[model samples]
Target: MEVKVKVWIEDDNRNLVFGSGKNEILKYVELTGSISKAATKAGMNYKKAWSHIQVLENYIEDKLVITKKGRGEDSGSKLTPKAKELIELYNQLDEDIKKYSQKRFEELFLKKDELISLKEDDAS
Candidate 1:
């Protein structure tokens, strides 16, 4: 089956923020070692993105990213252990879901035409 999968956490504002995006931000933080650069690549302003990170940290009850004062371009931002774990979890969950979907729908359900027809009719 051709299924699309999505995973996210909803905020107090009912916003569906993706684990993937946050993970990418963490990756960029590690690569560039700057929250500012990470936020920019994520198409977010630094302060606003920082605020979002803060919200997530509060939700998880742990610090995700840490920033440091730069001494003439020798310092920047980095992801904490919590952040790495969160990202790894996000990736693992996503993979598991995808695998399950393929096994359940594409393989197992492919032969179940009667059930699929009923579902399609109900949708229409």
Candidate 2:
């Protein structure tokens, strides 16, 4: 009855880099400014969350966040400009792809179904 899609970015080795899951983690980190807080918010283990971030940064060859060593407001994780850009681009691409897929699905599958259903209704 409807179309669904899951989009992600991968490296040349087909390594998963960015997707909805990582997107959520990054968004939470961007909000909380702490990996621990982000992990808690996402209901993920802190180590797993950190590992995921590490994988993303390693694969992209960029620093996704900067963490300062302190206990005051000046010390917390902050997303880099590149990380923000990557998030924006990935979100846009995912949305655009889903929109295109739904449009095509309607044109091809739903339209045909409507025609067939109408034909049956007329006969009955």
The numbered model that scores best in TM-score is 2
For candidate 1, which ten residues in a row score worst on lDDT? Answer: 109-118
Q: After superposition, how far is residue 52 of candidate 2 from its true place, in Å?
A: 1.2
Candidate 2 C-alpha lDDT tens digits along 5-89: 9998888888888898788888898999999999999999999899988998998899998999789978999999988988899
For residues 1-124, what per-residue lDDT tens digits would candidate 1 score against the true structure? 3677777767778875656777777778878888889889989888877777887787778888877895766567878898888888888988898888766776654564433543655777
Please, what is the whole-model Cα lDDT of each candidate in the order they appear? 0.76, 0.87
Pairs that collide in candidate 1 are 1-106
Model 1 whole-model lDDT (C-alpha atoms): 0.76
- RMSD (Å) of each candidate, 1 decimal: 4.1, 3.8
Model 2, position 1: C-alpha lDDT score: 61
Candidate 1: Cα lDDT at 17: 61
